[model samples]
Target: MDTVTHALIGLVLYKSIQTENLSRESKRALLFTAVAGSEIPDIDVVSQLWDRGGEYLMWHRGITHSVFLVPLWALLLAALSWLFWRIFDKRIFWLGMLAVFVHITADIFNPWGTGYWEPFSEMRVAIGTVPIIDLVVWALILAGFLLARFGKKPAHLVFRAVACLIVLQFASQTVQGLAIKESAMSRYDQVVLAADFQPGTYKVIGKKGGQVDIVRTSLWAEPVLLHQLTSAEEADLQPLFEQNPEARTLAKWAPMVVVEDTPQRLAIYDPRFFDRGGSFLFESMEK
Candidate 1:
């Protein structure tokens, strides 16, 4: 999820809590825990500033987002709350855990996955069932806010319902994406799915040998061919990797890549980001 969505989720988490009996200072501490915990994992973005090796692609959403680090992050937030508010409530730690855990788990449903297992495993668990910026999630959260503000129902209950609806939406979208992926297995050697911003729609990318196809698919409609890409299977990529560190990093980070070999340059790019005849994740070496 994007930073704004994560922040909104943090606010929703805070709103879902029953804070009527808490002191004002405690409430402030809780708010800080929720919002900061939600955003702590993304602090890895700072690695880019020091990434002379061009490994920022693997570093972002890396170990900091790992499940193993969740407890530690929560502990840090809890201690900070204690220092700031002189409050030692266990709820602070628990809420921190919830916020951080939700942040990492939510990231797994998108195409740019986090390193969930971290040191235990380097696998990037990208389900790609949700877009990075999902309008539906925003709408659901907004509805919760409106209901809490104007409706007769309790704020906590309304926000909880919103959370449940978000879960259902992700579950439904994932199931449909998985079905589309499974159906494409017969046609390709490798397959990946990226959910469209519009719900129930997906981009199904399949690779068979050197050929890659990006297809737009939905539960109720026939798959429409979007883009066709070819990889230079015969091209020697070792030189490219040796000369361009970014190329090596791209190869390791991307689930699969489309290789472009021409007289002027040799390039490899993640097909998932292909748009307008180019990709933002492309790495190349001049011939």
Candidate 2:
């Protein structure tokens, strides 16, 4: 998910809490805890500044986003809240934990994925059921905000309703993606589904031997082929790896990739991201 969505989710979580009886200082601490915990995992972005050997690819969304680290993050934020606001409350720690957990879990539904298991496992667990910036989620959150401002209902109830709707959206997308994958499996050895900006639409990537097919699909229509790609089965990546370590990192980060090797260049990229004449996630080296 995008940073804006994460921040909004943090605020939504804070709003969901019943704060009518809390002191003003305690309220401020809870707000800080929610926002901080939600955004803290992304602090791994700083690793790029110091990383030189393509380690940033592995480090970003790594340990900081790990499930095991959620409690630690909550504890740290709670301690900071107490130090800064002098408001020591167990509810602050729980709110912090919920915020951080939401951040990590939400990323799993997006195509970019997250290292949920982290140090324990380097595997990138992405369901690819939702776009990185899902407009549906944005709309839902916006509606929640509007209701909170003008509706007769309680603000906490409105936010909770939005949260339930978000969960339903995730469930619907996951089922649709799985169905597409199941259909693709009839003809391909491997299938990957990447959600599109348009709701209910997806980019279905299917691979068999060295051939990869990119198909645009939707619940209401049959799959349509957008591109056909050929992977270089004979390409030796050691040279590419030695010259551009990021190539190796890309191979590890993506669920599957199509390797391209020609006399002039060597590259590997996730076919699901292929667009125009290139992919955003591509890593290449001149031969």
Candidate 3:
């Protein structure tokens, strides 16, 4: 999920808490724990400043987002709260854990996955059942906010309902994506799905030998082939990798990639991101 959604989740978590009995300073500490814990995993973005060999591609959602590290992040937030506000509530640590855990878990449903088990595993676990910026999630959160504002029910109860709806949405999309992949299995050696911006829509990439097909799929409509890509299956990539190291990083990051080799240029791109004439994630070097 995007940063805004993460922040909103943090705010909702904070709002759900009963803070009436706490001191103003203690309440401020809780707020800091919520927002900071949610946003801290993304601090890995700073890796770009120090990256010289194109390692930032792997570093961005690396070990810092790991499930094993969630507790440590929570502890750190709690320590910060103690240092700054002298608030010594144990709930702060647990709440911090929840915020960071939510951020990492939400990312798994999107096409750009995080390294949830990083340090132990280098895999990028992307389900690709939801877009990075899902409007449905935003709408649910917004509805919770409105309900709280109007005192329709308890603020915490409204948030709990919103949370349940969000889970249902994830489950629905995952099932739809799996069904689409199963349907494509008979026609292709391997298939991968990338969720489209519009819900219930997907870009299905199927590969067999040197031929790759990018197809649009939806539960309510027939599949449509958008692009047919051909590649030199045995093309040498040493030169391409030497010229653009990021190409190597991209290959490792994406679930699968298509290589394009021609007299004019040499390029590598994730078939999942294929757009009209090109892909946003394409890395190429002129020949």
Candidate 4:
């Protein structure tokens, strides 16, 4: 889910929780909290990519996306938001929770997963069904926002629209996941996707050459066969490394082209979303 989806989701949740019982001020404050909370979880990306480089290793997709941050951020913001909220409604607390959950939920759908249960399992879970910027969901949210803003639509209609978008995205993801699985099977008879990141990206475990081949997808990443760890490849890589160890190092971070029989095979292992060509032997992951 993108910012629009999350923000609209927060608005919908806030509206439902405080349907009819609201002083003008509490209602106003919840709206503020609604929008802010909806956008806040992505603040973790700031700690990851903004100041630092895009490297996922550089404090990216880390604790900020962790489960701990849910309570940590909710508590931190609740007091401040509560002060501004004149109407005392406990429903506001759920609104805060909705905002936080929306952020984390959206995070999981991205290529660089939100590390949802971080500090518990350092897993990067992705649905890979919905493209992060899903047009259908966006159109629905944008229409809902516009409707509420100008049309003065009923709050119930606003809430239903957002829910419909969420459900639509969920359905899309499910279909996409199945499609990828079917496609993976098409390429290899005994293919197994160990982990799928987002929008058709995955970490694949394929049974080939009487062994398990671990295939990783690069950022903006497309899948490629890196190397089969055979005795021949092992022997070849050693001397190759002895000549230019830098190639191995470069391959660790991004794609490296190795031509054979006038055709080339690429190797990629870095966590970048897309490659911006650097001098190292590896090619950029993007098209």
Best by lDDT: 1
Structure candidate 3, residue pairs in collision = none
Lowest summed lDDT across 10 adjacent residues in model 1 is found at 161-170
Q: Summarize candidate 2's per-residue lDDT along 227-254 as a digit string, tens digits.
A: 9999997788888889998989998888
Candidate 1 wrong stretches, greater than 4 Å: none
lDDT per residue (tens digit) for residues 1-287 in model 4: 66776766777766555257656777677787777777776665555345422344324455666767776666656676667754555556666766787677766655445567777875566544445566666666667767767887686677676776677766665555555557666554355342343434555444444343446553345667543432122223443344444445434322212312111432323222323332223322211
Estimate every model's Cα lDDT from 0 to 1: 0.93, 0.90, 0.89, 0.55
- The Cα error of candidate 2 at residue 32, in Å, is 1.1
Ranked by lDDT, the better of candidates 2 and 4 is: 2
- Which candidate tops TM-score? 1
List the candidate numbers ranked by lDDT, top first. 1, 2, 3, 4
The order of the candidates by TM-score, greatest first, is 1, 2, 3, 4
Superposed Cα deviation of residue 77, candidate 3 (Å): 0.7
Model 3 spans > 4 angstroms off: none
Question: Tens digit of lDDT per residue, candidate 1, span 1-287?
Answer: 99999999999899889888989999999999999999999999999889999899989999999999999999999999989989999999999999999999999999989899998998898989899999999999999999999999989889888988988988998999898889899999999988899999999999999999999999899999999999998899999999999999999988989999999999999999888999999999999
RMSD, model 4, all Cα superposed? 8.0
Q: On lDDT, who's better, 1 or 2? A: 1
